[model samples]
Target: MPPIIDPTKCTGCGVCVDVCSEDVFFGSKKGKVPVVTYPEFCVHFNCCAYECPEEGAIKVRIPLPLQLLYKGGDR
Candidate 1:
């Protein structure tokens, strides 16, 4: 799933944007919360959440199919 940014916690530091390999986020340099432009491009790498300085600022939800694939099991 795509990362969801908490506007309240996001300081618009652009760390999430800079760390994302899929270019999922976009925003201005004037401290605006980055927007998720392409969710399908996200590979669930968790880089955005990992790089976010604010706790709970970015949340990444892996889809059920992807979760099963990663877990090596069937539901």
Candidate 2:
């Protein structure tokens, strides 16, 4: 699934954009917000989610099959 952005909680510090090696997001200079520029490369890595300082700024959903494997601590 795609990475979810919660505008209310997003401080838009661009941390996620900077941390993402895949270039999945872009920072907006006019506003304190980051936009999801490339949704397809997300890969449900959830790195952005964890990197976000806001409690729930980014939420990435992994597919069921992969979720199961991830749940087993493989990922």
Candidate 3:
């Protein structure tokens, strides 16, 4: 699965857009959170998630081993 953005926690910082190695964010405004422009480039690297200031706002697919760390266990 691709990354999903939670607007509530999003500070509209636009850091995700700026740090993206690939041009994945297509939003016009500077502060507007970028949209998933190139889903294929995501690669589940969690780059955007790491840059985001708000917790749980930017979520990328977790790696298999780490997935078990999320309580309730990996699905």
Candidate 4:
């Protein structure tokens, strides 16, 4: 799934844009929210969300298959 940015919480620090290696998002100017230029290009790696300093600013959905694997540890 593509990353979802929470406008209310986002600081527009461009950390997400800078950290996204897949280039799924386009960088914005200083203090501007980054744009999701290629949502489909998102590989669900979550680098952007992980690196974002703003809490709840961004959310990335993990793929179901990967989610299952991740949840497997809960067993």
Candidate 5:
């Protein structure tokens, strides 16, 4: 799964671009918001979301095939 960035919430801080090891995100040279340029490169580690300073700025949805592999737990 790839990281989905919310333009409204993103501050274009470049943190996500900096933190992504897979080079999935691309930050604009003109200081515009970054984009997920390579979705297939994403490993679904969610480093982008965790690095985002703005809440709800990045949403990483697990792929349906992978989602079925892990069972939910009730705490």
Candidate 6:
């Protein structure tokens, strides 16, 4: 699944668009919330969510199966 951008928090800075390698927000404009253009191409990289300047702006949910397989970020 693609990352969900919270319109309430997003400043339309286009940082997410620049950081994402998947071109998920290809058509989004400079002063508008990004659009999830190609959901099927999403790799669940979590880069967009991590790089978002505003807290709670971007949320990327990893499927349960993939969560179990990766076993990362455990501290």
Candidate that would win on TM-score: 6
| lDDT on C-alpha atoms for all candidate structures | 0.81, 0.74, 0.74, 0.81, 0.78, 0.85
Give each model a TM-score: 0.78, 0.71, 0.69, 0.75, 0.78, 0.79
Flag regions of model 5 displaced more than 4 Å.
Answer: 70-75
Candidate 3 residue-wise lDDT, 1-75, digit = tens: 457888888878888888888756765357776678776667677788898888899888654544544457555
Top model number, lDDT: 6
lDDT of 5 by residue, 1-75 (tens): 468878888887888888888878754432568877878778888788887889998889887766655568855
Clashing pairs in model 3, backbone N/Cα/C closer than 3 A: none
In model 2, which regions exceed 4 Å deviation? 27-31, 63-75
- Residue pair clashes in candidate 2: none
State the TM-score for model 3: 0.69
**Model 2: per-residue lDDT, tens digit, 1-75?**
468778888887787887888877754442467777777777777788888888988788765566553345443
Residues 1-75, model 1: lDDT tens digits: 567878999998888888787787744353788878888888988998988899999999887767653555555
In candidate 1 the C-alpha lDDT for residue 37 amounts to 80
> For residues 1-75, what per-residue lDDT tens digits would candidate 6 score against the true structure?
668888999999999899889888888899899998987677888888888899999998776556665556867
